[model samples]
Target: MNEGKLPEWLHCNKCNAFINSLSNDSRLYILECTHIVCKKCAFARQRQSGNVLCPVCGTTCAAKCIGGDELPHDVQLFMDQSMVLSELDRLRYCVQVTLLAQLR
Candidate 1:
């Protein structure tokens, strides 16, 4: 999603970067804690905490919430890049095999 398209006020709780929801329904939520973090950040945070604190309010909240999911941009980008790299590797491997067969 385009960071420019996001509203001025909306930002990721951790990095303060633009929080772009994959879908229109996504939103930042405090997991019963005081902190209010974007879903993406919260997921990452959850991994560390047995129960993560709400970035907004610091209240301890369960892993599950209404939406209860983070859509971190970095994670998405990394996953995308991973797919691209994997495809490139596959293509290169195929080319290498073809070349070896032709030489034989």
Candidate 2:
């Protein structure tokens, strides 16, 4: 993920609440329209307006739209940190190899 991008994505698009900031029982839903919402708001919208629409793009979702394991905040954070660490390790290795090649 780009710098600060994962942080941006880990928030409910509707309420703008941080994913981790939500209650432990709260579930996160990712919309096909590339939006995300907390289960509370999702159910509320469905109960009130009788449809599951993307709060961001206003796109309609299928009847069972909230069942994806996609990019949970914890997993996304792990992945992002792993990527940065891997790149740093690679650069460190290159520097070591270059030093060894220089014979000094």
Candidate 3:
């Protein structure tokens, strides 16, 4: 795989980091809020308090799991779509800023 291309399933929504999803010793956690997070970030949040909130939605009911397979299909699809839209919006903002700078 290219160094700059991350597997879709390995994208962590919390820290925006690419993680190894296939490692047996990997410590990735999937939240009930449909957010994927690295173990280090999850633990850090928990250490700051007794419960860990979903970094994406600020929900306090997230459960730690290895994957998001248990989520309902509709929920999963919605999450994926939201992530894509978020990325597109960010790219659009960057492009707009670049164009404005050139015109100034």
For all predicted structures, in order, the TM-scores are 0.35, 0.47, 0.44
| Arranged by lDDT, best first | 3, 2, 1
lDDT to native, each model: 0.54, 0.59, 0.59
Better of 2 and 3 by TM-score: 2
Candidate 1 lDDT by residue in tens digits, 1-104: 23323343556566575644545445554445434566666666563447775554555676442222353443323234556688789999999999999999
| Candidate 3 wrong stretches, greater than 4 Å | 1-8, 21-25, 47-50, 67-104
RMSD per model, one decimal:
11.1, 7.6, 11.9
After superposing candidate 1 on the true structure, give the runs of residues whose Cα lies further than 4 Å from its correct spot.
Answer: 1-7, 20-26, 47-50, 54-59, 63-104
Worst window of 10 by summed lDDT in candidate 2: 62-71
Q: Which candidate, 1 or 3, would have the higher TM-score against the true structure?
A: 3
Cα distance off (Å), candidate 3, residue 45 = 1.6
Write out the backbone clash pairs for model 3. none
Return the top candidate by lDDT.
3
Q: Decide which is better by lDDT, 1 or 2.
A: 2
For candidate 3, lDDT tens digit of each residue in 1-104? 22222245665677777664534344466676767777666655563445677667777755554533453232333235566688789999999999999999
Residue 82: error of model 2 in Å?
3.2
